[model samples]
Target: MSFINFEILATSIVILCRVVIISLERLFPYNAHQSLLRKGFWNDLGMYTLVQSFVLSQIIFGFAYWLDGITELSSYGLLSSWPIWGQVLLSLVVHDFYIYWFHRWQHHNRYLWRTHEAHHSTEDVDWLSGPRSHSLEILINQTVEFAPLILLGCAPETIAIKGMLDAVWGMYIHSNINIRSGVLQYVINGPEMHRWHHAIDHEAHNMNFGTKFAIWDWIFGTAFFPSGRKPVGYGLGDENFPENYFKQHAWAFRRFRKK
Candidate 1:
């Protein structure tokens, strides 16, 4: 199929996944009081999710095209012989592993945390909340994500499929649905573990760094799962965090305050 058609299909699947996840949140909400139209909903949806995503996707792909031009990497067809499913799986696992370490590093390093703080700034983290990330954060992560797929000669369709996987999994891990994954929670990352990563409680700091897989946290001893309890609140817990999209992006650039 053509790249345009594949993109259209991937986008439709993401929308459908959002609808289903939202429905599940209504039925089995982990935080039942959290509203669908929570505070900063429009800024998160209209500006961060839709507008930023469209612009960044274009820039990321453009960069990928430019890089391919310079290196002519795609001409080597490095991964062309792999089945489409294998290529998708390879991208998912490799990037998930990379992100696991990088995400942990972001929590520890003060400078990197600036670019990441806006993501954890949301008091209400729903499916939509997953996309309320700083543009720099998305730009960096997505560039790392799609660049290799393009350069390695994966089919153009692999990009759309991997992109869909990322969207759906990100929303799932951040959705407020009260999941009961039980043993599967050990292997796959979900809101059960990830929601606490956003918790304002001191105990949750720097834990649950895995994105699509929980194995990294388990192996690295960063997992935090307190049974029969929920986080008291989410976000940075500072009253000064900006709600405006432009301000939130700019907030990341502020000088470090003296302790």
Candidate 2:
């Protein structure tokens, strides 16, 4: 199948999941305050549409193609010829490892934090919230995530499958309708741990930077999971953060908020 076909299939799955999960969230929720029309609905919808749009995918693919032409993926990387599944497994580990550092710096570094602040401004963590990110940040993230896969010469099929899995896992982690994943929580990233990463509390701050696996946090000693308690809230407690998409986009540059 072509990239377009993969995108269409991914889109259909995402839309279906959103509808199903939203319905379930209304009937049962991890937080009783969960609402179908909660805050930032439109803003998040815009972000989701932008990320899932063909334009974004084309840009990503274009960049990958150019990079591959220069780098010319050789049969060297550890994952180069291992089965597709093995390539995907190693690709994920490598990609997540790269993002882990980037994500951590987005919190620790002042300037990077500004670019990433829009995402954290979300008071509510839901399926849509996963995509409510600054466009530049999204570009950087995709670069780090896919650069390794292309460089490793991973098959296109493996890349597509991994991308779909990543999207589904992202939606799952951000969904409001939550359920613990038992021991899997130690392996797979889930809401139970992810929520704490969004916590307004100091202890939860600057921790749990893993995008898919929790092992990175464990290895780095940055993991924060306080059992029996959920994040009472989210965001940086900055009332200055704009709620609209355009304002949020300009926020990193417009230091002077016009009255």
How high is the CA lDDT of each candidate model? 0.92, 0.77
RMSD of each: 1.0, 3.3
Candidate 2 collision pairs = none
TM-scores of all models?
0.98, 0.86
In model 2, the runs with Cα more than 4 Å from the true position are: 1-8, 51-53, 74-80, 255-259
lDDT of 1 by residue, 87-206 (tens): 999998999999998888888899989889999998988898788888888888999999999999999889889989989998999999999999998999999999999999899999
CA shift of 155, model 1, Å: 0.6
Across residues 90-150, which tens digit of lDDT does each residue of candidate 2 receive?
7778878888899999989878987788888888777767777777787788877776777
Return the clash pairs for model 1, or none: none
Q: Which 10 consecutive residues of model 1 have the lowest summed lDDT?
A: 128-137
